[model samples]
Target: MKTIKGNFIFDKEENKEKIDEFKKFIEKNKDRKGPLMPILQEGQNVFGYLPEEILKLISSKLNIPLAEIYGVATFYSQFTFIPKGKTDIHICLGTACYVKGGADILEEFEKRLNIKKGETTEDRKFSISETRCLGDCGKAPVVEINGKQLAHFTKEDVKKVLEKYK
Candidate 1:
């Protein structure tokens, strides 16, 4: 229960509703066969991210050990323990993109946003991530801002591109 940055502490009044919903969801699925994964996924969908509290609830309600829940969550990249930002910036770092200065584009984004890869900005306005591939290597060095692809990106365009989000 140590405080981890970005994971919502479920004790907040605002999170009560979400916590209740998570409990209900777990209860509804408790009778199903091999329900842990689906319950975890639904909890993430409901809460936006799988914070510690939600996992604890799932584990307690399902009669599964906390370590087992943690193990399953960690095994899947689809489950993020931390909260995502308002805008998710995915910079491609695949072989094609990297060969074409994608790494430089990623660095520029980190510098401009003041956050390293996989970290969200303090204001929560943006999260910078290094994506394996954006599926558009033809336009190598592709950047996706909030799921909107920006192909053939350049460092000079960084300021202008970010300004649009602001």
Candidate 2:
């Protein structure tokens, strides 16, 4: 039906071989009753993220309830249903960091990126977020870029780090 973002769009001709492979895997594991995770993992790897249609297809193929499939996916934080940006910026909002201008840093990031928390830029390069703590409160006002942490920064420091993405 309607095309959905962060979801699967079927292409029979392009995916024929892969779909056949998945069918085999499902059939082989049909009797085992624990193939859901493996199937979803593989699906996410192939598709970058698990879409609703793909989950349904998986549930139907495995004879697992759709609710269980969805529940499992939603239960795990490791599993991402939405497509992720190339670079992730996590600004800590921990108490130490907060007083040290964490909020201001976040605000500056929003102003520069022109995207709010949980939103990916149109180019899909930057995904700015706020997190509770990065476990380095001593380095108050920390900003993590693509998993690397830089702490004890000023507003200018935030700007310079983000400008590299452009």
Candidate 3:
């Protein structure tokens, strides 16, 4: 990987290394019964997310249809096609959080981050997403960033909260 003018670009050698790793994973699981799911899971583990390029490689290596592989990938919520940002912002949208104005908080984050839920910012510093619950209803309208929860935050206080992160 090479960063050119503040952008991280994967060069040809890096792509080859990544594909080689994927091939090793395929070789390990190609003969197992019901290997596609495991292969995909391991691929996700190795690559963080399954892009079309990697999926196509897997399909070709396993002799499976790309459409079928995509169907499986889409069916599972755990599988994400997009890469996660360095900072993960999980805004709880559960009944408790929403009742306490979680929606407004979510909107505030979207406005500040300039990206909708499930999107990473261009700088890759932040990724925004909504969750059903963070299991912290006592602190309704909770926003968890990078596994740490900031509880009882209001929309008016969002800027202050984001300041600590930046």
Candidate 4:
């Protein structure tokens, strides 16, 4: 099996709290297996993504194995093992947008925000990514700041937009 690469140190006390919370969550849905997803969802909400420590906690509480928890988390894309930023900046790299300077727009955001794709800024306010498409091709070269759409942008427009975020 390929290894999962991450470095999330766990505090035993915090893990215990999260474990207790997860137990309560599961008990609330004792009659239904459907609650497993929600149980894991709450876990992710608390710990950012399913870290080893969290998976172990869940396994211990649910009497499952760590491998199964990790497998389930990896099978789903929405389960992130790392912390996400407060604001997510998505730059569309669709064919039309890319041809019309989408790459440059992404670079501008990176330079201005000082963060590479899939990484949050040092202040934890901004996270940036080059996405396949945002479906705003009519306004080619589009970007979204914290899911607020901005279309038909140039370098100057990017600067103006970022000013508000900063």
Candidate 5:
């Protein structure tokens, strides 16, 4: 296994296979009218997150500048540079949730996990993110862990919730 950019770990053989897969995808899509976005999206899908090497490969293959690719990737919130942890934690910061102490719940998560929003723990056990809404405003201050919603969440519940995952 090899680690790329000190964050992504992969088996050398597996990485080669993914690179080959991405290369084929690029070949099929490179000549499309607007190929960059699709290629970047597919690259992220292939690698879990877009690392520098993959971006550079896309640039080289498409004859596009690396900066242009980075610009496009950064402009969209849908794309992330860091890989998500095995467990994803999303705290809703919608109007209702934020008013109901959702921000405080998020702070508690950061403190407990020792990682800021949009970051994964060093061990990659958990990643924390914020969502505009969870569509259950009636149960304000919601926290979704691994796609399971915990509605009406509070800071005090953080420990108990985390313990369940542990």
Candidate 6:
């Protein structure tokens, strides 16, 4: 099986290095109080996204139930099960941004990228997601690409911004 972003599921052979890294992370941190969160975060960092195999590994090493691990991971919006594209786009939907045509900007991205929010393109070049706020209300309609913010973004700017990544 593969994830929506085309990452193979349970292909441990292909992910041996990342799995080893995650194992080291787990060994180094497993004894700490409240280690699950950090373990999961590091797992995501190492694997790009947490797959079932990693989750199961965590459960086995920590002796935590798989269901419990899933519960915690799912509760956090920061954890994503699917691989994010190389260029991740986040559009703010905060009140200020929405009022400034943020929705239109998001629509423009969807139209141009041919993928809805929370989905990565088939080629894995881009992924679109939305946030409630980007804390740049003054700029309104903020678009964040790989951690860099594009303030006062307009629908017309999407093409140019995407060109930079391409």
Q: Give the number of the best model, judged by lDDT.
A: 5
Predicted candidate 2 versus true structure: per-residue lDDT over 1-166, tens digit per residue: 3445643344545666776776787677767757788888787777656667677778898777999998999897656666557888888998999999999998888888898876667777787888888999988989998899998977888678877877
**How many residue pairs clash per model?**
0, 0, 0, 1, 0, 0
* Native-to-model Cα distance after best TM-score fit, residue 79 in candidate 6, in Å: 0.5
Instruction: Name the weakest run of 10 consecutive residues (lDDT summed) in model 5.
Output: 3-12
Would you estimate the TM-scores of all the predictions? Answer: 0.88, 0.71, 0.86, 0.70, 0.92, 0.88
Q: Quote model 3's TM-score.
A: 0.86
**For model 6, what is the error of residue 97's alpha carbon versus the real structure, in angstroms, after optimal superposition?**
0.5
Residue runs of model 2 more than 4 Å from their true location after superposition: 6-47
Off by over 4 Å in 3: 1-12
Model 5 C-alpha lDDT per residue in residues 1-166, reported as the tens digit of each score: 5656656565447689889989999999999899999998998888878878788889999999999999999999888888888889999999999999999999999999988999987677889999999999999989999999998899999999788776
Q: Which ten residues in a row have the lowest lDDT in candidate 4?
A: 1-10
The digit string of per-residue lDDT tens for model 3 on 1-65 reads 44232233334366677778879989988999999999999879877777667788899989999
**Candidate 6 lDDT score relative to the true structure:** 0.89
User: Which pairs clash (backbone N, Cα, C closer than 3 Å) in model 3?
Assistant: none
Tens digit of per-residue lDDT, candidate 4, span 13-76: 6567766776687667645765557768888887666666666666776777778777878887
RMSD of 1: 2.4
Best model per TM-score: 5
Can you give the lDDT of residue 162 in candidate 1?
Answer: 83
Residue ranges of candidate 4 with Cα displaced over 4 Å: 1-22, 34-36, 45-52
Clashing pairs in 5: none
Q: Which stretches of candidate 1 lie over 4 Å from their true place?
A: 1-11
